[model samples]
Target: MTQTTGTAGDPPYLRIVATIRRRIADGELAPGDRVPSTRQIAAQWGVALATATKALTTLRLEGLVEARPRIGTVVAGSSPAGPAAPTAPTARRRPSPAPDTEPELTLDRIVRASVEIADAEGLAALSMRGVAARLGVAAMSTYRYVPSKEDLVLLMADAAFGEARPADAYADADVPEDWRARVEVGTRTLWGLYRKHPWLARVGSLTRPLLVPNLLVHGEWMLSALDGHGLDPTTLFDIHVLLYSHVHGLAVHLELEADAEAATGQSEDQWMDSRAPVLRELVDSGRFPTFAKVVGSFEDGYDLRLDALFDLGLRALLDGLTPVVEG
Candidate 1:
């Protein structure tokens, strides 16, 4: 039930978030308990779905709620001092960086700030001014370390890619049981990184790749695993590229989904609901008998389970490659 909180001045989403946060704090919502989802919050609080989405995002940023695939949001073990607000200013006012008591601005600081901005608002909303505000520096201060937004984005992608590596990178004798295991590790690691930093999927094309050294580390890991097989160099690298593409191609949708949400002010579930009539009409039309028959059979309808699709594609791709590698 929506509360009658007199939230006269504060934003509606923030009020909903505040209510949910209170529930978590009062032990009404235990850790691992299913917290109200965006839709549920919208219905309960009588707010727009967009408002509800922003509210859940705030709770997520605050570390009070965490989203689990297919399970909805849940309470985390503890909440930190709350993450920096993801909401970017609508007006692009250029302000001198505010001084903080911490150390001077550095490359690491610049890249981290850039990543945070891109993560929250998306790449299009990112700017030197926005990043400067984030770092408590002047609008132009970021220019000292990174020349342009494009250059800074390259650095951000590189830093994010380097954040994690396979266990074999550190171990002397430890290795996966087989080549497949090794390849699985590399593929999943790349996918996980994309999941963490959705913007990474949009970086560097295949031919005109991002010339970042850290990203090359992942390449080295994958190539090394594929080397000993009797396959020709062309086939070997081709297979490596294929595996990477499978993960990379699907990952692009992650950023796109975020961008769509921002532009439409509607969540994916909401958008799908809006398009339900057209989908139903297409099924009902007698033009495509086979299509209608297949879709009609789904009790719950087709859920676009991307994670499951990634696994499904990977297994099929590897199965097709087994002969090429073993041949």
Candidate 2:
């Protein structure tokens, strides 16, 4: 059976590219139909957004899809007549910067470019040199703005976190009143940020937390929810950390999964399938009656749902803490 999600050894991006190519060749997608956005592709195929972006990039390179200014990514040509290429823009000339003039670069621009790079490719693929190359300047030029790659990563993370608001912020102009409800919304908002930016999860840890201002904004919101609940100072803070960890702990897998797919060239299913023989023997050995029975009971094989796990973990954590906070 052709597994829709990461089933073959081929990278997820390649799978996405090949699928689009087939649709084009088979005329299901057609020449001018607007192709799915990266987010859409990620949602539909359960692949990382970076994987989806790479697939679209590959499609562009193969002349199967083209980016239009207002319409977004679409099939290359109306009739497959030599893949539609981007229309040449009206040429404009710029006075080169005076030899003595410093480059028109700023810290914000540097961080923005770095974030863009990390978003499209994982953090490992990011570098001072790469960022400079992307910004069309000398590698050393980036140093003037960002002292080092590590510093750049922190700034990039802060900027990314800055893009999103606490879930409570998205509600009606008036904030949610109940502490539990606010905490739930706040935690989910953090979850959404991690979902949108997988790299953020790897940016910091519990011990070495990212102390960016925007992220602190999120923390304050969560902490405020549990404030004045009669809980001790340490317990209130502990609850906040626990909830953050639950979301972040699961999010780390997002990047790791992408990295694994690229490294092993196998989807999770494909990797698991390789070990099927061993699993089968263990399940059938009859030595572990309980394990075998559990395996045999699945009407449909177990679904490894990180999302469901996230929700369940959040609920369970909240359930455990509700009394502690109110007690």
Candidate 1 lDDT over 209-293, as tens digits, reads 7889888898888888888888789988999899999999999999899777755667888898899999999988899999999
Compute the lDDT of residue 251 as modeled in candidate 2.
93
**Pairs in steric clash, model 1:** 96-138, 97-137, 97-138
What tens-digit string does per-residue lDDT give for candidate 2 at 185-216? 88888888887778899999999999899999
Span of ten consecutive residues with least summed lDDT in model 2: 86-95
Q: Give the poorly placed runs of model 2, Cα more than 4 Å off.
A: 1-104, 167-171
**What TM-score does structure 2 among the candidates reach?**
0.70
- lDDT, candidate 2, equals 0.74
Error of 1 at 283 (Å): 1.1
TM-score of each: 0.70, 0.70
C-alpha lDDT values of all predictions: 0.74, 0.74
